[model samples]
Target: MLAFDISGSMLKIANDFLSTKASCNILLYQGDCTQLFPLRSNSLEGILSISVIQWLSEDSQIESFFKECYRCLQMNSTAVFQFYPNSPEHADQFVTVANTTGFHSYLIMDMPHKTPQ
Candidate 1:
């Protein structure tokens, strides 16, 4: 498994946590997600991120990020991104970029506050 984070500290923390539990080899890298990853094409089985995508300050950055995600995945691979959009327009932008980059994307809302107590 491969994990990327902008914060070196977060990557270290996740690596430390995973070391105690996970049996599979996990590679951790700290860098901007918008840039091309060091991995070879069609090498990754999956990509996952939480509260990460929405922070891209520009549309081009988001596009580059999605393009990298698509390029790094093998055929029929999948990625799950969890982000809080600033508005409906922001959400639409994400879907647009994903489509342009060859991903079949969907948004799964997690409304914890709306759940019945």
Candidate 2:
């Protein structure tokens, strides 16, 4: 699982995921998640980033990160991602980046409040 932002709730989710599932491997990193991806591995089956996309501060970087996410994933792979669509405009941009990334994705709602900057 590729958890972006590393926030408190996200950290709790990560901890739970780790404790409950011992069959998979997990790695942790600090900082922007978009730059943290594009991992080289044919073994990677999928990725996850919950309530993290909205924290993206730069539009260009988010787009680049989407590209990286596409590259890191293998064929038939998936990324269960989510984020708060604070405004219609912000939502549009996020959707645009994900759509243009050349990866199969879906818009998941029920996102929490925005992270404090």
Best by TM-score: 1
* Cα distance off (Å), candidate 2, residue 2: 5.4
Instruction: Please give the CA lDDT of all the candidate structures.
Output: 0.87, 0.70
RMSD of 1: 2.5
Instruction: Tally clashes: model 1.
Output: 0
For model 1, how does the per-residue alpha-carbon lDDT over 51-109 read when each residue is reduced to its tens digit? 89989969999999999989999999889988888887888899999999899988766
- Across residues 13-89, which tens digit of lDDT does each residue of candidate 2 receive? 77687878768666654555666553684446877766667778698888877877777788888877666777877
Best candidate, lDDT? 1
The alpha-carbon RMSD values of the candidates against the true structure, listed in the order shown, are: 2.5, 5.6
Checking candidate 1 for backbone clashes, the offending pairs are: none
Give candidate 1's TM-score: 0.86
Candidate 1's C-alpha runs over 4 A off are: 22-24, 112-117
lDDT of 2 at 39: 62
